[model samples]
Structures are given as structure tokens and as C-alpha cells.
Target: MFWIDDLWKFGISAFVGTLTVFVPLLDTRTEALDPIPVVVTIPILKDLAEQVGGPYVRVTSLLSGYENEHTYSPKPSDLIAVRKARLLFEIGLGLEVWISSLVRNAGSQALRVVTTSQGVELIQDDADTHEHPHTGKHTTDPEGNPHIWLDPANALIMLRHITDALIEVDPSHEAKFKANEAAYRERLRQLQKELSDRTQRLPDRRFIAHHSAWPYLAKRFDFHIVGTIHLQAGTEPSALHLQSLIEKIRKEHIRVIASEIQLSQRLPELLSRETTARVVVLTTMPGGVPGTETYLDMLRYNVLQLVGALETT
Candidate 1:
């Protein structure tokens, strides 16, 4: 098994290694690149890269909104992005399985891959280990909950990582990164106040999410995750699974089933009917849906949705 794994790894390495370059450039311009090419896994980093990179940096997001970050298929163009990127930012904690191979193929240790989920508290997926539908188990944040972005307080930690990486790669932009971090941190603080106030109004602070994506939110707002609609990131729920969740809902009187905007809503909506719980769409990724474009707005939108759903229930 070990040799087999090694051989498979070698095959992937060789393929990606040779094809790293010659793919699409994120944004094309004739001038010599000034800031740096930074490849990020999801939208939050893209948003941050925009703020911190400003005019100096050029950013490319590997996964689009329709593309699930967890189970991403790297086009040759993606390898090209990795090949050219001076720095790669990811939510890490095994959130991106393709990173290791892609980096290996790019053959640039100097690329400086930064995992934003670093140093934040991680919750083990102890509820169950099955994979969900629409993607693989690899698509799920395997190291732990990579949804640290959901917590505004935790995003501050990501800013530190971003600043350090930017300063390391482009020391000339140290002040710019610092300034960006300071400004973003201030906005985060205001968002914290807003989230606290909004969450405080939920008469029933307890609700169940489709998965175990709510611990940070629950911790922040004193809400409770009564049960999960799915056991894993893409695994389908069986009859037994549905029956078990129904029992928990009945016991807890779970008012809302917080289905993430990124995931398919069929199961959550169906579970909502089963439990008589309202289906609430929450954004895990920045811009995962229509209303959650900015970090603060995402939190506000989720809190408002949760508060409104639970309060009315």
C-alpha cells in the first residue's frame, strides 16, 4: 500500500509538474508584473488579496463559485496559476488536497503557501466520517472545520497570516499590508458588535445545521446545534440516518435547519419538511450566494437569517 501510494503520488507529480505553465493567466496585462501573482483557493482570500494587494498585486482564484473548493478539479490552467504564483493562500487544514500535488508540480517551494485556517481553533468532525454528495470526502475540510472564516474574530488571525506572507514576498508592500490589516480589523470589530447584538435577539438560541458547520457560530452567539441533516460533506443520508435525525429534532424541537448556500438544498429542504423546521441558507464561503459578498455582510446576513427564523419560530 505504501509503495502503491508512492507510485500514485509520483504519477500525479510528473503529470502536474510538466504541465504547470502555459495555462491561462488570471488577469492579463502587458506591463511586467509589479506586485506578485498570488493563487488563493476561495473567495475570502480573493477579497483580502484585493484589499491588500491593491494596485501592486494580481490575484487569481483557483476555484470559482460554481466550482466546489473541497473537491476541485485542477484544469491545466490551474497548474499554470500555481506555476506563476509567487504566493498561494488557502484555508488549509487539509481543506485543499490538491495543494500538495499542485505545488509539487509547480516545483516552487518559494511560492509561499499560506493556510488561513492556521492557528485558529479547529473542531474535529466526530459526528461521522462518511462523504456527502456533489463532491468527495476530500471536498470536506478533512483536517477540521476550515470554515474559520465564519467567525469574524478568527478572521483576524488570517489577517496576520496574510500580512506576514505579503511582507515576506513583497517587503515593499509591508506598510500597505499593515494598513489593510488595520482597516479590515476595525471593520471586523464593528461586525463583531453587530453580530453580537443581532444574535442576542434569537429567542431560541438552538438550531440544527445540515452539517457540523455551526460550532464557531454557536460559540459566538450561544446558539446550539441540535443535530445535522447530513453526516459528511457530500454523503447522502440513508433512511436510518434520516430516522435518527428526526428523533433528535423531535426531542430538541429544532426550529431551523441551517443549510449552507453552497451545498445543494434538496436534503436540507426535505429535512426541513420532515422536522417542520424552516430551511435557512447560510454562507460558508465569501460570496457563496447572492447576499454574502463581503465578510461583515455575510455575518450580518446569516445572523439576521438565523435570528429571524428562530425568533419567528
Candidate 2:
């Protein structure tokens, strides 16, 4: 027969042994259930986060593909997203003026804001030529133009920023994040090469941009931008500017006018009517146009559309 105290001790030991075995299992289950939450200002960033994060993160984008980045106002849901996110990615060249206020309003101490355009070389808008009156102030970095992602090279830099942020937050998944980034970059390079082959053989690559958003794209693929319709966002060009563009198009025999879907088609159409140039509508954001749901698809569509127009003209 065992003493009462000895029996009690044995029972307690057994309970402790069982708990020791189950505690780690419980921790593992909990960790698996909780994924890192991320928020991005634009759709492109959201896509990038998804590509890098894979199954480890949940991402939300504030602006859909059709919205204008320069003039977008934040919604109530944006604040809620920010409050829950561990990381918030933005382009941050004064492109998202509303983001600062949104983050402040959320007041999440743990949320980290990552600027993906930190290392990108900026194109300075010709202040002398690109000026217009505005109904309200637009956010443009005095340092340079904010539309850096249009260039594939700049996209690589943005990817690095995103990968680094993911690694910092979730070190355990560093290997996966790095691998995803590498694979994505390889795909980007391949696409760029394919597009370059298409554009390189073109006889004429000159076109008028609908807005001051094509400089980076033009520089990357050797396209020449002869003129821009809207030098400033939300401001109509003066009659004098329009007349000059028409005259220049006729004089230079510029055959194509590249218009963005996000902007009003009124000016591009008017210019097309006044001049002989054909309008080739393109999208700056993914999913703005059909077959452009992803970043790669958007790039291919824009390049091929412009190339086809240029070749025909």
C-alpha cells in the first residue's frame, strides 16, 4: 500500500508531464493560426506583398486599380486596415499625401510604415514646362516625379525594400521571402527582355503623353515623349498649350498619343480630332484595363499596345 502523500505526488508528476508535452503543441498551433497582417497604399504594393509573403502574410490595399493615386481620399476602412496591420507599405515620394494622416489617426505604435521608393532615382519634372493651376493642392515630391514604378528597373528596387521589411518583421520566414523575391525578379527580367525585343525594332517611338507620367517609361524603353497634355493633375491645359501640341504633332508627324485610362479622355480625343495622331489608351495601374490584372500583365499590355500603335502609324 502506498502512503496518501506519495500517491498525491505521483499524480502531480503525471499531470506536469502531460502539460509539458501539450504546451509546445499548443504554441505551435497558435503560431500557425496567426499570420502577419500587412497593408499597402496601392494595388501594386499589395501584389508585391502577396508575392513575397506567400502564406505567411495577409495584405490589404487602400486604392483599387482604377483610382487615381494623386487625388485619392482615404476611406474609413483604410483606418481600420492600418490599425490591424503590422506593416504598411507606400511609395512615399509625396505620392500618398493622405497616408500620413491615416496612419496618425490609426495610432498603432506597432505598425511600421515602409517606403518602397527609398533608393529609386527620381526624374525631376521640368518645372519650367510642367506647370498648371490646380483646384486643390496635389502631392508631388519636390525632389522628383513620383511615378517611379513605371520602369522595370525601379520595380526591382521596390521589391528589395519589400523583401527586407518582411524579413525584419518575420525572421523565421526570411528564406521564403528571399526566394519569392528572387523568382519574381527573374520573371521581371525575362519580361523586360521580351518587351525590349519588341520595341527595339520599331521605326518610330515618339508619342505625346496624356499626363506627366511617362518619362520613366519612355526612358526605360527608348520611347520619346514629344509633349504632355496635362502637366499638372486635376488641371486642364491652357488653349495655348493645346494649340502648340497640335502644331508640334503636325510638324513632327507624331502619330501616337498615349493616354491613361485613369484620366479623362476628353483632351486626348480633342487632340486626336484636331491633329492626325491616333490615341492609344494605356493603364498605369494593374487591372485598370482588361488583361492587366497583375503587374507583369499590365507591363506587357502597355508595352505591346504602344508598340503596335507605333508600328502601324
Best by TM-score: 2
* Top lDDT hit: 2
lDDT of all predictions? 0.75, 0.88
Q: What TM-score quantifies how close candidate 1 is to the native fold? A: 0.82
Model 2, CA-based lDDT: 0.88
lDDT tens digits by residue: candidate 1, 1-313: 7966766878977756645653344234433466688999887788777776688778898876555556676889988998888888898765677778988998876588888877898766543444422234443544666567777778788878887888888787789888988988898888788778877766788777876667777787788887776665556668887887777877778778898866788888777777787888887666777877766777788888888888898
Given candidate 2, what's the lDDT at residue 207? 95
RMSD (CA, Å), each prediction = 13.1, 5.7
Error of 2 at 169 (Å): 0.8
Error of 2 at 43 (Å): 1.0
TM-score of each: 0.82, 0.88
Ten contiguous residues with the weakest lDDT in model 2: 130-139
- Residues 100-150 of candidate 2 have per-residue lDDT tens digits of 999999999999999999989988776565342122333343557778889
